[model samples]
Target: MKVKSFLLTALAASMTFVACDNNDNEMGQLDNTPKSVSINLSNVISTRGAGQAIKDDSKVSLADLQVFFTNGTTLYKGKTVSGTEAVHYFSTKDDFDSRDDRVFHFLPAEVNKVIVVGNNGSKITEATTYADLQKKLAIAEQQDPQKLDLYKEVELTSVEGQDDLGHPLYKANVVLEPRVSRIEIGAFKYNAIAEGTPRKYTSIEVQQVMLNNYFTTADFQVGTASTVSKEEITAASVFGIFEKAAQAGATNPVWYSDVFSADKSADPATKLQVITLGVAAQYEHAYTEGNVRPAYHFFPKDDAIGTTNHPQVLVKLIGTKSDGTKEPLYLATSTFNPAVTADFAKIYVMNFEFDDEDLDNPQKCVEVTVDVMSWDVVPVTPEF
Candidate 1:
């Protein structure tokens, strides 16, 4: 059992939830969907870790398989609140191994959709990415204008691809209206922002493809292109990517002493490029006049938070006292993001709270640190 995993020293980071079961694996329930009839990604798969429990971040890339699921329902990332939903799966591939049970919990939203793509075509799986689908659909619309209408009802679903990881890969498809073209907002999910803006457009749908979250090395543009395991490198890559983003947009940069070791060796006055991941998150918010974003992050309080900057839960204080005692002493609020940036330009949002006596609320309240920095397109090692 030669098991390999990404060993990450917990950076200064925090997650907002921990929705897993003992056996250490469980997912959100799907809306009205049958358990017997899941969109299968694989009929079978070969792996040694069959009965062996999977640790977090371990992935297996699925090989050959078939996908089966409800053919004609417009599915998105979200599920019906009051109805039973179908479960999702992922295949066990060498390249993409399932961390735990490889279960695709259909959370009640689109962002959770794990993107899966077909062999080069735009048709993606539940694991497919929305952005990629949009890109491919746009290309198809431009390529074949005359055949556009004929391809109108063109939709896609997961074809059984692999096992465990198989189900998620194979059956996941763009669950949306058939023949009826639709589009959604990106980045921000706030309804008000979506309804108010028009930049958001419907992805071209003359072909069979959908949006998902299957990230790849294609996103980065340096060094030898290789697909690393999700847990092993995704978070690290996210840190690298944010580093690139920060470098590209940072201004009036400041560096802090490493959280691991308190050393003021680096001069704050001098522009410091590479900063520790922890300190970066502490200050990863927006500055300037006014950019009203929510402040405070809650945890399922899951310890193993994903490296990817995930949808954080908003914090709201609720009180009254449990023992039916005096009025609950309202403490403070907090904001947290699983951000792992190598370098940040502007000041990012803060996570620490002020003491009870410190009522100024000046430390980190009602503000977000929009880190404008560049991610590491290449590894920051001496060899490179």
Candidate 2:
């Protein structure tokens, strides 16, 4: 009886071992190949404080977004699982992640790093290399000079988990960096003269406005040349919207007061105009040649006060003298140095107030006070 019991136990143990071996073989047959990757873009949001009265107003759209991979030396192309060129052409922000159209598959173990550039209403193609990307940027800039390019990088050194089908799943998020700096020029005309003060001027009107020493992509590494000289790039004119108000009650006459900001605390008769411009931001490292930093201005240059070069003038305000003759008043210039950061957008709000300490000499240099308002909005994620 003892020998029978021992033999029965040995037979059961053998069967159990065979069953475990079969399960191992089945598991080994499952596919563990790297198929596709999922990206989450919902974390892209503005980093500015909500309490600020004024904020940076720039629209962000993922439609026509293009992405490629780089292993620091070699570049690899990525495409959607359906074989269509990979693009995040979503019209609305809703359901950014749930959509199956966002998934892209790359070559197995080839996606070491990725660079994503945001689309500002421009078509983008697959750039297999860094040189291709620079070339593409130049073409895009020429096509849409006013539009901006937001760039971000992602590292795929780590893997998330497996998909339902048991493929190697890699997940990432693309956070954007603002490649342009925003410039907002606010002009406030102080025409109100106290009863005892001397009359300063009859009236003033804004002529042409120009930005001096503004940086473009052509001024930096993204341009055609490896190095850009200051003389190669110069100033650009910003033709702002001008509205002429008719006499007191003229028919269909637009009131200047109504066109400016809602803050009507100033005299209704005072003249004011606001114009905004978007300029490309420069990288400090790009300006540095070797160990010495060149005199190149990485920050946006503002017209310095009392500078003979005519400080960066927002508008060439033509002031009417007491004799009814029109004269030029250098009323628009600021000393504000505006810069863009990696995590947020920098907007330079310049308020120019014109005042004459000695009313007797109205033609002399008018006292111009410039107040620079800096707003840091637009959040950017850390480098992956």
Candidate 3:
């Protein structure tokens, strides 16, 4: 049954969309007007199931973790916030787990909404456009960093003559880089609901494994690369959504399933599901090179069903009508990319939407798979 129908048109330009706070709220679409919100983040490394462990396979010490919020898609003037490193103080755990505290702030009056940029690059991978780096990141995060550790070596030493390029290993260049073990993010804040129900998510956790870096000396192996095919992009490939959902119960039960799709061709076309779910939650990893400069990557609030972000994501449906002519099925779904602050930590009660077509109740179950890919333009001169 078609639940209902409404036209969706995002009045703001996402890539160039500025903060819609008080400045432009009066001039834009009413539904997506920028509203006030508070964001909070909690780092629960110890309690998370992903098993928080730093993969310092490259012999690098963690300098610090900072979360950036941006009004524009890029992470420049956007509010910059740092995540507090919480050791074993908050919870009872074995080895110390570094986590973060909460950071919530009101949207600046000049911005429409905010977006987060999880800067995970020390060497600046943001130099790559959405096309080049998206695939690179997909492949890198999937690799096992343990191969480069020091303890895994056998005692076979090839003696090299100083003049002979043979056995003598050139004063081997030792490199230590921290591969993110576990990345956790939580609710910064949200639009207060009628009842005192706890907000959707308080935190999320991701894990990584790499060779340990504590050893003073050892043979460091050369780093390898990875590959990701278009086929590799699917719901199963997405690991952040379910992880977050398990942590936070659904404020909107099928929000993920509803907003994850690429069916711009659907009869109703792809549209945004703007449930009163004024609530938005996210957890993403900004992989850093040498552990600095992050490119924001976030998980949609209900992406377990399908990945969502920047305009909602959706999976389509195919149902038989009484007449039998194929109609643009309204999965009654769409993608939502909320405007976020620069801190990358604020849980802005997202006043965002997909200015797409109208959707009604979907008739039949449509077999669809949604893959959320995040990439951006790399200008000749980067602001940062």
In model 1, which range of ten residues has the least summed lDDT?
1-10
> Model 3: residues >4 Å from true position, as ranges?
1-38, 46-65, 71-74, 78-110, 117-135, 138-140, 143-384
Compose the digit string of candidate 1's lDDT tens values, residues 331-380.
Answer: 12222232423221011222322222322233212222232211001111
Candidate 3 positional error at 313, Å: 28
Q: How far is candidate 3 from the true structure (C-alpha RMSD, Å)?
A: 25.2
How much is the lDDT of residue 52 in candidate 2? 19
| Candidate 3's TM-score | 0.20
* Least well predicted 10-residue stretch by lDDT in candidate 2: 11-20
Q: Point out where model 1 deviates above 4 Å.
A: 1-349, 357-365, 368-384
Please name the candidate that would achieve the greatest TM-score relative to the true structure: 2
Model 3, CA-based lDDT:
0.21
Please, what is the whole-model Cα lDDT of each candidate in the order they appear? 0.21, 0.34, 0.21
Q: Which candidate model has the greater TM-score, 1 or 2?
A: 2
TM-score of each: 0.17, 0.50, 0.20
